[model samples]
Target: MELNLPESRSRSIRCIVKLGGAAITCKNELEKIHDENLEIVACQLRQAMMEGSVPSKVIGMDWSKRPGSSEISCDVDDLGDQDSSEFSKFVVVHGAGSFGHFQASRSGVHKGGLEKPIVKAGFVATRISVTNLNLEIVRALAREGIPTISMSPFSCGWSTSKRDVASADLSTVAKTIDSGFVPVLHGDAVLDNILGCTILSGDVIIRHLADHLKPEYVVFLTDVLGVYDRPPSEPDAVLLKEIAVGEDGSWKVVNPVLKHTNKKVETSVAAHDTTGGMETKISEAAMIAKLGIDVYIVKAATTHSQRALNGELRDNVPVDWLGTIIKYSK
Candidate 1:
């Protein structure tokens, strides 16, 4: 029953978990903030923190859609009942997925999009949305008794759209761990000075957290299972139990057109979200693992936020323990 984690590893080490909307939200990605499934996830996280298995810092992704946008209208407030048992004990960071995705696709505002000349009006609008999203999570976590802080690339004078150098911000995350407070971050469409408007996903946020803080574990609970050799829908596709993220970035390309593969991961393999594709997740993992952090890709169905926090989804395998470990790896 004792987890053979290293003695050097702090029992209170901060854990940076990236939650995908597909898994946390109800069908069609509806914002059911008070749904039973979410409560279960929160309970699992709280239990893990209470047990000292992971640090008290638990962050969630809340995509911030544009103001007056339909996606943002889904649900904004509601952490848990004020008197609920799982009121506090963690930090939550929700991305503006509803807003970012739309803006990125429609306005062509991403690190790539910003490469071209853009008007100041457009830049201001994007920044506002990004700031508002970060603030919303901060407010919610504060109300829940878990003091949290917002760390955005923009606040750092970095573009929200592209992957710029973030060593200083990473250090800030380390400080969060040292101080016993949780820091929440999300994938943002930042204003890249070089790339203009760049899009960063929640996975990228976790990657930055892992590389900087070097947490004991990084759990990404997406809509599907772990990684597969081929698409999971195919009958012959095999689930990879464990993979040492290839440094060559070979896993970066699953298909010619699709930069990342589109399959759910099993309990013991590297999982990929087809939308952003597998390449993105693989690259991020490669970077995190280099710092000696372990990343697990779990399907939201089996391991909501809470289940993952309790280590129920961690594979028992005793390898160096880096990159996408599922239950079967043991």
Candidate 2:
């Protein structure tokens, strides 16, 4: 039940990369995988592994020891000795976009409690759909020659009545990483102590793993490039290249001076999503950032998407990075 990783493994940089459901699946279509995008990300992961280098750059106060710069710097010194024979250990968690969202929404899975008898069918349907998608993802990663092991959160994680993660058995996840296999997990319908069942988001899974694994980086690959001053759909919207987390774990826009007329920032979530969309992702990343781990939110469809997941910042700077950098600030 213990991770019991070797001292060498403990010193290696550990990363958790999340592929958002929206990034991999067409939310409007039923169980459709974005094959082209998935292939891009998979190839990137394989390339990173083959090269045996950290892909993305780490930014913010936690990493730089200094702040206020337009871009954060990477601390290569902390990246432990690079071994050509082995790749950095990573844990991947993906969302259930078109696969589970439609069914979960219909089943009231996000309601945080038991559902009516008729709604039970929705719950069953949601699980089947999500599992099917998991298989597809695993197949794709395998095709790219990435050693992947699919793990179901339902089998290992539990949540409270309020739907917060109560406990999860991550020993297997840790073991898989130690064995050099990427553990693939997804959002799932799980048994809740107070509620008969509820939806457990992949974002929540990342948070829990971060607490346990203390990964050096947590990257979220989504449909958008990164957090924007306004929704990306807005013409005036500018990407918030970097965000700082307050001492109390609140989010602070690092570059709030962008010229955008919209005072209110809106986040886009797919119509079928039962989980809070961009809002929940940002909030969770901020909390993780407060723990001194740098979090990157980037678009998975970009050429740089896979690089971001590997912890590689495009220009070795946060501003130039393709995604939003969330880090802790004083």
Candidate 3:
């Protein structure tokens, strides 16, 4: 079906949050969700949506204005909206976490050819697992008095081609946010044009929605502080406070807690994650930054995350927010 929604690069969304599977679930364990984290996230989301400014253009490193030197022109794009109106509309997408990964891997659901009994059965099983978690999150948000509507990717007409998003009918999603209700989506088992069925990751879903909705900013909530110099579990890991993305899509750590020459970032994915974990988050976050949108990758259930989701990152000139801000270095 043709979505037939009014298309605008301008902001119709306040923010898009991706709840990482690892952060909300015990990834190494099968189908286990971290209940406390989910509740915290739901409450944090409730507070954020309660207050938000309208969408505005995100300013970045505009060398043309300075000519000789680079500078953050409003940098709040350094952090959003053309209308100057006051409203907060949100679309939330969450990862499968420990919920569906094991089932998907066992049934080879990511391969897409669902003709086999194993793949088909695995597809249904995977949905059941992820949706169970979805229901929990929805209930938590509901308990917080946030008007949340769960919209599954499969049920919402989202499909992929060769593991990339092919088509998604987000008309309902748009309508939900416009009507002041949050649309909660999760990483899902989806039908693929090339492969019979495959897993559509939450990271990919966030990018797709950002491209279409152009929210003022995007937030990625995880368990760890933010983007790390290496695996967060490692002894030598350091949190990178800021990242700058070039037009070419390459990224470098701008503000490392411990000064070092190596600007390259690294992250290790869990074995159960069919979708690439931390690495995928950085890559997609860079893409969003390239669109001149600021991205906040922060630890959930923290003062930093609370500040981030509430749109308080750009209050100071030096930008002293605790989290990684993926910025566009144009």
Candidate 4:
């Protein structure tokens, strides 16, 4: 089937943005999309793309006019032209939340492949549920005039015995992005060589794409403002504005909270989420950070919290950005 897409422009900044299931859906409920929040995020993404004032040259530097710095000489005219036509090449990945998680867990689909005859039915149920959510998300992006195409990992992705991605046919995804269509992918049940079928987490999908696509930024839009010293619900918990990876590719939290064992950190999955939630997200971000790409974990449900994803903040200035930045030290 041929997909109608916007015309492509010159090579532009590539970004991979992930919409967390908890942020976009009432994860505790069954397949309920936070319509208002979803629309808010969609609109903000459109606005960010349309606004040409965003500097695109540097990864993590102040936008100030530094002498001999590419950041200072960024061609605003080029950006304006690109925005007037279409957003830079970008991809969106959303979590399944209540859509696929509940069904998958009940059927034990995450355990690997469909070894049991009963699991065949569970696989179908899980796929159908996730597709429903994908349609809803595509519709939301459509309302914002985004030429969004839905790509199911179940159709094109495979896993090894370890349940990790063995191979995925991303050719169509690349073609779609290059053709100026935003491909929306979601975590779903996929065929596994060893286990039969297993659940692929959205975090895993983003990591895989980052390795292949080599985008300038990978943003995880979640329910919380950013990574915190501890769970935000706890007393005196402070948000960690930035996390720097060491020369050896190891990351450490600078706050003294790491010294205290009494404080509890909330990395548990949501009640309905079968995939490891915040814990998985942090680990994925760490892996991407080791590659020298900056990853931001930010809240997406509110207009105020959408700044980091909007591309207005300086690449190096996470303090001014409204999120926890995972990056390597200079």
Candidate 5:
């Protein structure tokens, strides 16, 4: 049978997608066996490949916490015998979990978790760790045929003068898009003028990417099944089927531990250590849609990614992508 390829106007309309970590990580509960959830995500991705419902060059990001800055090793030699497809034509970026968590926590460099000022020594330590992590990821991707490059949040030249992601020309990514290769990126530690020092999450990287690529859809395969008005872990929570990015472009902050009262208000909370979360994502989506792009946030563990990519088209949006919508007003 002939495979159904994704329909595209230009067949070259670049799609800068962001796949979340939790969606692809091995769950602790099932560590005894092959991680069923991670396998499921891979199966979905493989299905998408078989169906030809996505771009030929697919970039899969595994934004997990790395061991540590010193231990951070992206050496292809060390990755001996790994599947060629894992990095082929894919620009990959992953966070250093051990490095970031340890340094950030030690130096008190956190947005949601910290209340006190960061010590200058700790602050510099965290920044260096993040930068080193990016370099390791680049090396690994490059060895796997991705030819990846690391872009530091600092020294990248952003208008805000804040070193979140140095707002560089994403032409390399566009070039990758055109050549049917994947470009992977992740969040970096940043020098926030307002906050002094902060960690930027990979979700923030996705946002900045969307701004540049303007893909037909930006899919965020996160841990949860989309954001809930209330914690789905709780009994009374409701899945917010859709959300419209407001003119002001801020998301409503709903704590998983707290009950929500007003559905009408846009809310946001401080991201744990990084500057990315549901709120950050929604805000970024709003900014991207301002350029007429569409965004989809979905749960990766489920079959949603495959369904969303290959499922029937509806109202200019594909089904099963599952997440809140950030629409643009005509």
Candidate 6:
């Protein structure tokens, strides 16, 4: 796939965050949500996003830099000012977890067998399940006083060809940022030109948006502490604290030389997931890093994730922080 960058923006998007399905939901329980975890995440987001929740017409570049800034609308673009956002505007994407995974997996929806009656039924069921989850997420964020607009890929004009991104117009997403409203999108059942329909994962969505929007950084909030040397729970499993990606998208663990290539670097995928799981998440993170964007994968609701979300995870991270950082090789 080509790295097609979007038109120049005066002020680039601050950051893109992906909330893992397994991290926020009960994967073992069908359609069950982790309410307490969601509340914790919402409160964390509120402290970051809802602090200066007022709509401002930021007219000039240094408006926010000035103390006691007022609602200023500047017609001039910020020219992709790296510090312009201060994370005032951002995007959020989440996975299906136990929500739509069961129906989609049973119906074989991702394999593009929608011509069958059962497959079609599964497609409908999957969307209904995931969208219900999406609304719940939106309500949680809203309760924190964050203005959130829920967007489904199916309804947002996002389609796929051969299960790859074929048509995805994110103008509305950019417009949503311009309007100071956070856009919350989730994994969805998308129409595929080759197959009648297919599943679009949130990880893929994060990569697609990063390739186009060129955000300051990206964060993945997951269930596990971070990437491991092998499948998690293994006795000898070693956490990969940092990874560096080559220009061609190849990545290597920073300190310990990993003998296994990405092909052999194993990860566990949920049985009900139509889209790939942890493996896909890591793959997407590397691709984003190839674009020179820092990608952080940390456990949700942890102090590490809070710092990452609030733009506090800089080059000089806390010594005790435990997570995987994928960045472009120097």
TM per candidate = 0.62, 0.83, 0.84, 0.82, 0.60, 0.84
Q: Count the backbone clashes (under 3 Å) in each candidate.
A: 38, 8, 9, 6, 11, 9
User: How does each model score on lDDT?
Assistant: 0.49, 0.77, 0.81, 0.75, 0.50, 0.80
Runs of candidate 1 exceeding 4 Å displacement? 1-12, 25-37, 52-96, 111-146, 160-162, 166-168, 233-237, 246-275, 301-307, 312-330
Please give the lDDT score for candidate 1: 0.49
lDDT tens readout by residue for model 4, 1-330? 112223453464467889999889987789899998898888777666655554333121113456676655434454444433556677999998779887898888888647686688888999999999998898788666676888987775545445778877767688778777889999888887778888888899898888777777788988888877666777776777777777776666653345564333464357777888776787788888777778878889655355666654544454455677888675
lDDT of 6 by residue, 1-330 (tens): 323334555577778889899888988899988888787887676555533544243222222223466675443464455233344667889998999999898988898877899999999999999999998888777665566789888888888888888888687778777777789999999899889799999998989988888888898988887888778778877778888899888778884566665445665667777688777877889999999899999889888888888777666677788888888996
lDDT of 1 at 295: 62
Off by over 4 Å in 3: 1-4, 7-11, 52-87, 257-264, 315-320
User: Candidate 5 on 1-330: residue-level lDDT in tens?
Assistant: 111222332344434445554443332321122235445544454444344533344333333346665453344353455444422232233333334545666766654222354556666777676666555544443432343456554444321223355344455455654455555565555555555556666666666666545556555666676776645577755656555555566444322333645554332232333444565566666777666666656676565655554432225554435555556554
Candidate achieving higher lDDT, 3 or 5: 3
Alpha carbon lDDT at 301, candidate 2: 60
Q: Give lDDT tens digits, candidate 2, residues 28-91.
A: 8888999998988887767666655443532111232235677755554654663324667878
lDDT of 1 by residue, 1-330 (tens): 111222242334546666554445443332233244344544454455555444334433334566677765322354353232232223344444333444444455553554355533444555566566566545444443344578765554434423553323444554554455666676565555556556566666666555545566667765556566666677865555455545443333221234345543422222222126555565676677666666676664343444555555444643332224521111
Ranking by TM-score: 6, 3, 2, 4, 1, 5
* Candidate 6 residue spans exceeding 4 A from truth: 1-10, 50-87, 256-263
> So what's the TM-score on candidate 2?
0.83
Candidate 6 or 5, higher TM-score? 6
Rank candidates, lDDT, best first: 3, 6, 2, 4, 5, 1
| Of candidates 5 and 4, the better by lDDT | 4
Q: How many backbone clashes does candidate 6 have?
A: 9
